[model samples]
Target: MSDRYELVLTCPKSLEGLLAEEAAGLGLAEVRAQVAAVQGLGDLETAYRLCLWSRLANRVLLVLGRFPVGNPEELYQGVQAVDWQEHLLPTGSLAVEFSGHGSGIDNTHFGALKVKDAIVDQLRRDSGQRPSVDKLSPDLRVHLRLDRGEAVLSLDLSGHSLHQRGYRLQQGAAPLKENLAAAILIRAGWPRIAAAGGALADPMCGVGTFLVEAGMMAADIAPNLRREQWGFSRWLGHVPALWTRLHGEAEARAAAGLSREPLWIRGYEADPRLIQPARNNLERAGLDAWVRIYQGELATFAPHPDKGQQGLVVCNPPYGERLGDPASLLYLYQHLGERLRSQCEGWEAAVFTGAPELGKRMGIRSHKQYALWNGALPCKLLLFKVVPEQFVTGRNEPAPSQARMIGGQLVERPPAVRTEPARLSEGGQMFANRLQKNLKQLGKWARREGIECYRLYDADMPEYALAVDLYRDWVHVQEYAPPRSIDPEKAQARLLDALAAIPQALDIDPSRVVIKRRERQAGKKQYERQDQQGRFMEVSEGGVKLLVNLTDYLDTGLFLDHRPLRLRIQKEAAGKRFLNLYCYTATATVHAAKGGARSTTSVDLSKTYLDWARRNLALNGFSEKHRLAQGDVMEWLEADRGEYELIFIDPPTFSNSKRMEGVFDVQRDHVRLLDLAMARLAKGGVLYFSNNFRKFQLDPALEQRYAVGEISAQSVDADFARNPKIHRAWRLQALQG
Candidate 1:
């Protein structure tokens, strides 16, 4: 048995109470929440167990010495006065971590360094030997915290941030930090689910952080069990027997948990980049045998499988706040919300979204919404109870707040009259008409200039709620706000008034034009309809036959944003093998094959898109000798390697389900995905990687090992006609002369 000691477990700001509950549940003594930490008392075994178990904590600090000091000198002298020999060996390694609030020690690092020097100087003067400083991995970890003019020093029991968990052998694009993930789960009321048996899922499971945290809670596994080292391991007072006993108890608890339904955990990602990492992490945590991993989109992902209804579904879908287009992301989120309501009716869901405007598109009202931080950006996690129609409420019941007296009466705007055909007021009908005519004129100009696709007007028609777009060989169906009234004559007059102004508003020639009404397609097919202007057309570019769509879907013509990437392919395709992945219409591959590549291979999971790609290749007059495969990219990449000299990887930012796979998110697995591309690249080959994920962080590990550069400027072309930042493009080369 070991002597009991009081301890304090600290967490990041705003997460104090969460840590307290976790500590108390671990059977620690006197566990109570304080300002920014949880205070408790326990034997040495309890301390060991807490270090290994607490998921929400930043680090655990053991109370070593406490002394009140008003100034920096006082802090240094007081720290130096403590018995250095009692706690640490003179020859061991030590590190200092410091944080301060409202203290004289405003520069935390300088204050921490002073304390370190004092301790070492004392040890050297008294014992003729001193400990070395180690930042990467130290033998003894010291912590200094200053709050309100007082310095509090403690011994760090957890060396690295507890969030590391040592289980992540690999990570995906924009993987959530582990501690933040735990905090989110707690905020989402995960502990309640752990108490009751139920399944948990991450529909857009980028690297599976939410699922893994939920699984750890369900299994009651110690968070630190997979960790390679802890600060306490090198503590002067560390007791081997006590640590061993705590480990045994934790193992016993895990054994007891095995009798229950293995905590239901699952993650689905259409992007295969996450599939292997999710598996690797689960296995590292010893939960691989328990959790299920799937590759598919969320839209087609069913709730009740052969067995039954899942208990919970959590999704952290893209908001397009920092990448691509925000409107597109809203559409994606709306689709996801529909999937939650229709496909997962009985299951509870927690959706984390960064953009509020996008959240409104979800249609279903969130029962409860909590604010959290995904890194520095503020995000909202909305909980949907997912009750059936009989139990449904018209609105989300608001949380109660202290009442206040009303200051003024509510006023409502008067409705417009319809009998007069809603006169062409200065800002309403007249304004819309001008915008529509201008769009038509712009369309004619684009056609004359041989522009395959171009914007007729950049939001010129605001009052009639219309957007004008021009595509070669066809005019696009404009996005319009439908008329509210049922009266036919009045609606027709308003429509004419809105359309009359298009030519002048955009300075276009009206003679070379056509207009199409935007009508809702029946059923879910509307979501997947590419664009209305996808009508088949063939044109010659640089003596190469090119096939283009004029009317069929929402985006049939081409992605103007990749003009630069297309040019790059044409430039590099001479006598090389070209690979296009997630190849939308095989446009880039067409350019490459036309550029005289020996071979071009296009891979996509959608046969619909594959057919479109083949059409694109034939339009470009590329030899039919080119290859096209419809399969999962992971399967395709693994089965074939070292085959291509130039590869294009521009994945969809987010999609729930496709015909072949589940959801795809680019932010979760760029590292390994890039590595796969590198492995497949012919010696000294190049990979052009681009993702619309604005929040994407290029893995530092990959950068250190390979030569990578941002080619966004080179990737943007005149067709995009928008900010070049719309997509981040990277050029990666294999290291060699």
Candidate 2:
């Protein structure tokens, strides 16, 4: 009767039903919810209204046609059958978004190109002109989905997604999308709470997304009122008068609602830099007068006294996805629970987090939890009412299943508890006692020296053949493979004893301990991954940050034995060009760059290590003037033409990597490697050569051409004092004529 057409409203997967309900309320006929989308019959006015008002919908698509196809040619012909003149002028620009796979459309980019070609060809043959593609923003956006040899074509009527509400000009790290934030509020019953004259607060608000959305919902403001444009604005079938009428009515309702007594909407952020941005965003949303933002810490957060009680307190806290440590986030969550319990007695709180295990650390029971998705990550929205019983106080005893929290302090829980006194074997007791003595001695020194990462135990006991390294709160245990002469069962027993005693003696959580076996490596074996977790932890050495993958590679990326050498390099690298050969993870290069080195060149055979080197440099704020090269060190030494004032060369003891042109035995090839590296050195340059070959002997010929001095004693740090044979070093300089 009124030019009826099929329409599809797309939203996030979990919000399809909500979107369908909204569309039905908008008077769209025959509304039905489907997977990730809603379908209905709607004319021009209905489409325009839905485009302007549906907050949950990502896109309002007008179903153009559906066809079956089994090949790329059929797909092209199917798209070409559409009438191009009805959607856009020949000069109008457009973009196609292709998705799914099958029927010869193997790639999204190739499918999109085919669709564009079909459109351009049709327009050119019909009107002698073709529209160009605009990727950023186009007059028309075409969406093509291919599934099981069928193609569904539609026109996207909502451009740039409805989540871009045009209010936020600034954002904190890992900001939540506006639509997801709205869904959180809806799930938490914020709209009903606001209707009853209740207030809202987000103590950890990042750029005020939830607060603005809440303010709009409370004031009856349209979410898209401030948006600059919509896809339907340029569509040929758009009804301008209908859109104008709906927009005017929304404006009148918003004005009337704003005239009422303002609701109390507030946000607080600990970062002072974000306060101004949050305020600016509020002003852009025209909610500056209605909402308030304050710079305050979460520990001291409280609702305004003038506002009503019994509202919603919502926040999307850091989940350690992109930043922060998951282990350390436990304290933040515990503190949040404490504050909410002590300060917000009657308020309801909702915490949206990707890490549910950390949420348990809150020590507060949740009344309800809604499964949600934050983009592709599965997450949960935990809702709880602030009651006195939900707050556990003065319970110093650790929960049986939870980590120990004693005297308001985070302490490691024992791995297991027994009523009878636990007994250790003679060798196991000796290993345990040795770990305790080392902790007392090295722990004092490490704290005094401000070193967060250091070797604690390095095979001090003959039976306990393991190297235990402390990385901040975590410990990395590497078990040196026992000789075949030893009984396999006996060796495994000793290894298990050492692992058990580590946490007990060091007071570390067993979950924080990572165990690996070290043996003779060959042909990229050292670089090969034993696990595919891809988990990286940030640790500090010499006041510089580095990423270490404990679960992935055999090596931890940072060598604890080279601490003093790195320190020496940093001290002497100021304003000089530094070069690092066989720079595994480039720890020395990071130290040099941090010490104001003029520039640096790091060479390694593995791209994995080079990428790690780049991350270490970037983590230390050293991005420019640093070059990382991936090639065999032998080949690179021969080819490098640039001169360096300071060079550090540390070669593996023996490597037969496939990437290398030939096998490299450092003991046999030391002289040749040093000669080539020294040739690229400036006249006054200093070359520091190091290796872990216990029986390495310096070539006398090197002393005949240069001033060579062994600095092994001076280079060994206190942590590796007992293991002096761990490495050897020599400082060489060009002989003065």
Candidate 3:
């Protein structure tokens, strides 16, 4: 018999069983699933096919040798015993990836070094042209695993982590690897669904990993069809013709699948920033025509497939370290469950989350749970059949009961579709009462001004200490961090009472309400990481749509208190150059642009804010002649030569951002900040300076140097009149010469 080489297919932990099943299906013999790997006996051709087709594997290793290793010396000697000449040229390059820890080789770096030294030293010749080390695209890649006191050495036939499928170069902050996504799809029974011409959808499809992986499987396309490089490409034993034939067959199968009608696969993402990148990834995978992506919110995620066609609803929602509020994350999962029960009846739903507690709170009973790993974090894949009976539907619903079959008989029952209302505490009733009263008062004012977002209540009761804001129908509840004097448990209890009172008090779905505790964070930490989920909301302000990320940022993009100021800028922006300094999301610049400003430039130190500003501008068709500068406003002003006819400066109360050259206190730096801005003030130009510092005092020198008028009262709208200290504003103009 020809050499029956050992084949080891590695995968994410808990995926070895699936990998083994796949290997057996692909005609590998004696396949057995082991820890984090599946080993089998296969010929070189079977190994090549496995590299090209195994969707669950991270690497396909061809075992070249195995030997006992008592210490570091034996580890090196074990690798040196292999005939390196047969696999690599004397002048070629090699890389070693060492794993496991034993036999005094606990450090992976040192272990890899030993393996590399052994290979290179064994290949050493008199010509002094020995093999060099190449981490990427090496002539040959060696992998060694130290198990107990033994070592198993192999050659890596798959390069660059097969998870890098060459399609998703751009991804969200916490994107799943392609192989993991594929395994998830398989666990969700996507193959059976796709064969029956069923549809697939992911409500929170970050970079469209699920949608693309599902599409590739449904389209009969090899997961690595587009990958150009492989570890075996440079191997001496690689059969070029055999590989070419396999590749050509994959291409033919892909073309034949593409010639048929495309499957109905779709992905929805709440973040606008990820939409284009997701689409680009789909395009790169050659699945853009088969898969479609849309900008959608999880709260409003309604999966609509072709008529009578229902398949899998798969999503890997953000959880654990990825999100801040456990309560808010519960509502996210609840939304997924609610959408499934109300919309996608008769479908299968798979939710992959690191926090199984959050998954349990989805209010759906999962028939099965699979243990999986996303990196080092232990996660679970909760699989549910989205029938009416599976929905838990209430806080006090009974735990799901297994179907009872007695004496070869089956009991018939209707789907137990029930929903118990969320209970409210005695204190919650008073909180709800206050919310209703405030809503009655502000409802008309909000409607008359065409306001879709406005503050409804701001700690009306000392016990609540919550600010309730209405964004269209969705309610954003921000509970100010409780005082140290207050009991922590009591504060949390009150917050929970307020949350329970919100949806009912506002006449909206509970999923529409998201609660976050507003703790006093350090400088710029709140704005540091945009919620990875991209919870961006587009609300209308001043007759122009502005993107406000209520889920992520501490301050909504539109500062409702500054409505009058933005309106003032908009009123006077016609045919004039408008500048917005420290423009958080460039809301004022958008107003200026919408009001037909000749040009608008916004400056800020946060790249995140600038990106938000760009999206806000694009949302309102305000891209032309508008510039978003990412730098300290002071530095931007000092280097500026252009003059603006209208300027709006809204500085922070205190900023010690590392991005800035020095600390900025509104009280101390207002004069210098304005002087630089004032120098760029064209003759007859108006500059509006504003800050949230309650103790702000405009320098006496500024009044002497320019005409100053305090418009703080005018800038505060009726909604903000309750707290005029929300911000202070002043209009400054160059004195007529």
Judging by lDDT against the true structure, name the best candidate: 3
Question: Compared with the true structure, what per-residue lDDT tens digits does model 1 show for residues 1-737?
Answer: 23767688877665777788778887778888886678888877777777888898877887766777787788888888778787788998899888874436778778878889988999999889999999888888888877776667888888888888887778876677787788888777777876776778787887777877787778877777767688878777888888888788878777677556776677888888779988888887778877888998865665554356367888788654221133335346645665665566677788877765455446566788777767677888787777645122232232334443456745443222111111233553457555466546655655565555655443344435444455543334354545575464444344344443333344444332343345443322333654443447665443345555534454444665676687778888999999999887788888888788999999987777788888777665665669999887766787885478899998766655545345445676677678887888888789999976668878778888788998887776443444456588889988775
For model 3, residues 1-737, the per-residue Cα lDDT tens digits are 24679989989998988888988998789998898989989998898889888899999999988899888999988888888888999899888889889888889999999999888887785345688888867888889988888788999999878888899989898999999999999999999999999999899998999988999999999998888889999999899999999999999999999888987898999999999999999999999899999998886676666676888999998874533365566557766777777667799999999877656556678999999999999999999998757766643333344465778888653334334544456898899999999899899998898888888988878998988889998887777888899998778667766776777788887766766667655567757764656778778888888887766666667778888988888999999999999988899999999899999999988888899899999999878899989998888888989999999998887788888787887788888989999999998999999887777788888889999999898888777777778888899998877
Error of model 3, residue 402, in angstroms: 40
* Candidate that beats the other on TM-score, 1 or 3, i.e. the better one: 3
- Candidate 2 backbone collisions, by pair: none
Q: How many clashes (backbone atoms < 3 Å, residues ≥3 apart in a chain or on different chains) does model 1 have?
A: 51
Q: Which rank order by lDDT, best down to worst? A: 3, 2, 1
Q: What is the overall TM-score of model 1 with all chains considered together?
A: 0.58
- Cα lDDT of model 2 overall? 0.84
lDDT of each: 0.69, 0.84, 0.85
RMSD of each candidate relative to the true structure = 20.1, 12.3, 11.1
Poorest stretch of ten by lDDT in candidate 2: 414-423
Ranked candidates, highest TM-score first: 3, 2, 1
| TM-scores of all candidate predictions against the true structure | 0.58, 0.60, 0.62
